[model samples]
Target: MDSMQNAPSTEDTQRTSQPAPVLALLPETGVSYIRHAWQDMLSGMKLARLGATLGWLDIKLRYRGSILGPFWLTASTAVMVAAMGVLYAYLMNMDVHKYLPFLTFSLVLWGFASGTLQDGCTTFTSASGLIHSARMPYSLHVLRATVRNLLTVAHNIPVVVVVFLWFAVVPAWSWTMPAACALWVFDSFMATFLLGILGTRFRDVPPIVASTLQILFFVTPILWAPELMKTGQDWLLLDPFFPLMEILRTPFTGDIVNAAIWPAALGWSAVLTVVTFALFARMRARLAYWV
Candidate 1:
């Protein structure tokens, strides 16, 4: 009995010798996780050259051995623009000279913004192998995706230029245009990280994103003018895409955007940036498993 008492109890030995159970494969706290996310994002930015090179390679591979290469996108866009412009102009009773250029510019910008968001939903999943094997920043995938789409937009812009000249539509450089472009880039970047992270976790996200974009196309004034909107229907201006599209299109078309566009655009940029960063930070550690 004395020997038994002198010896440590099983519970006492466990408490004394066993270390605290550590939660592995997880971040300690949301703040710490978010901090890590920022580090990766910043690191990705520093490696922009790699991301851009990967983006270019993606395009090259996509159109390999084709003489037209990315110009295929240009040709297709031109055909659609010409066909739609003629039919829509006739239906709306708008002058072909004016309507075609407006339509071209609007479609070009819309394609860039929408494509970025849609591709974002697959950013992580598409690079699953890379994510699993590579030690690079996760945001690099997002940047690469954005860069690829931007290159597509670049190819399509010449068509816009041709249409503008054909219709005698002169787009003067406006300070607002640059501002709008900056905002567009920021939105695209944030959306990629936000949607990409979510997309990896939820297999259903990509299709849902695609469907939502399709519905948004009809709601957005790509084929119609917002000025022609009825009075009580002014609520259409509050669409998240409306201000962003208007900010770019209005200035490019040599028209001034309403004052409200500034506030709306800025508000969205701020909110999306914050929310995206927080979410990405909280979930990035789990991304490896999800993919």
Candidate 2:
């Protein structure tokens, strides 16, 4: 009777045997998201060699059976440049010798910029199979798309060189040229990352981007000279593509780049990079799910 009285009650034993409460699943904070994004970007960059190889293979497979391979793009661009250069020069009443070089530089650079963005839309979606099958940094796919477009730009260099020789236009090399090119490259990566995320989330994004690019091409000073805009010459500064193209084209055409262009280019690049990184940080965790 004494032992039974001293023994613990059933309620007390149950209370003591129960497990401790677990903490709830908390959401990631802004700081943690940014940290993860930074880590992902760094990891992706380290795998650039794999990205480059895949990009090269993409080109090879695209022209597998063709004898001319990627040079077909070069030939077509050369032919288009020849035909359009002569026709537009006459139509605009501009001197062909002066106009062709500008047109060549503009078209080649525009192609690189536009192609990279367009391909950026498919950066993640196109690799959905690989993305699901293997775990890798999303930025690697971004680099792959950028590198592919870059290779196309490389193939088109011969066309630019031939035009330069035929017209005897001497490029005025400057420190600004390399600086502008580097900025352009950096901007491409930022744009690609942003576009890749949006594209993976929305299927309509690719068509929308393509359509917008088509409209921008005509409005941009690609086929005509900026000097043709008599009244709104200053408003050209409002055009996003203008500063980017001018900083690059000016150095190649032996023309003086406006002092204001560098600031504008840098400004645009900074804004793009910041916005892209922020959005990327916010969405990085959801990318695999979206893809």
Candidate 3:
């Protein structure tokens, strides 16, 4: 009778049979996203050799069947600089020796800066075939675009050299020139990273980027000397591009760059880096789907 009483526990058996709750998986936090983004960039940088090779191939394919190949870039740039330099010097009543050197520096650097950003907008979109067909870090495409533009800039360097020699102008070559060049390269990567994501997601971005660059080219001191601006001269310091151009141009032209401009340029670079990195982190995961 005691054994039968102990076995009469259906309620206890039913309670024990119930399943325990499963813990829900947590969503990814911002820190994790940033970490992953950093990994992606590092992985891409590790593939720099591949990126550079592909970039070189791009140059070759672009000018295939041409006699001068990449040297065509140097020749065309020289012709344009010569024509613009003569016309602008006469129009502005500035000495050709001084004006031509300044113009050469301005145009070459501006071409690099503008080309980087403009190409940045097509970084991922142009590589859609590779992205879909292969498994690689999205940043590799960004590096590829940056490398291509850098190669283009290298081809244009001869133009700068010829202009300098023609005018008998010796470069002041400062430590800051290397620093500025490094900054330009770093900024190019950041820009390509940010714009690549946006460009992949939005089809209209490239046109808008191109149009904006065109407008900036006119307002920037590429065609005219900053010293000519008597009014709102202080506002030129506020122009983000002016400081960048000044820091780079001054070292080559032997002109004095205001000490204040260095801080401004660094500040702008920091702002661009931080903002682009954050966006890249947030968008990194979505890139594959978007592309």
Best by TM-score: 2
If the candidates were sorted by their lDDT against the true structure, best first, what order would they fall in?
A: 2, 3, 1
Q: Assess every candidate by TM-score.
A: 0.88, 0.90, 0.89
Per lDDT, the best of the predicted structures is: 2
lDDT tens readout by residue for model 1, 141-199: 99999888889899998998898777777666878878888888878888988999888
Best-to-worst order by TM-score is: 2, 3, 1
lDDT for each candidate structure: 0.86, 0.89, 0.87
Return the TM-score for candidate 2, rounded to 2 decimals. 0.90
Model 1: CA > 4 A from native = 1-27
Per-residue lDDT of 1-291 in model 2, one digit per residue for the tens?
A: 999999999999999999999999989998899999999999999999999999999999989999999998899889989999999999999999999989988899888889888889888888989989998988898888888888889999999999999989888897887888888888888899889988988989999999999998998899998889888776777777889999989889889888888788888888888999999999988888887
Residue 24 lDDT, candidate 2, scale 0-100: 100
Q: Which ranges of candidate 2 are over 4 A from the true structure?
A: 1-25
Tens-digit lDDT string for candidate 3 (1-291): 989987948888988898988999887798999998899888999999999899889988998999998888788888989899999999999999999999988998888888888888878878888988998987888888888999998998988888788878877777998998888888888888788878888989889989989998988899999988888876777777899999889878988888788998999889989998898898877777787
**Candidate 1 clash total?**
0
Candidate 2: worst-modelled 10 consecutive residues by lDDT: 232-241
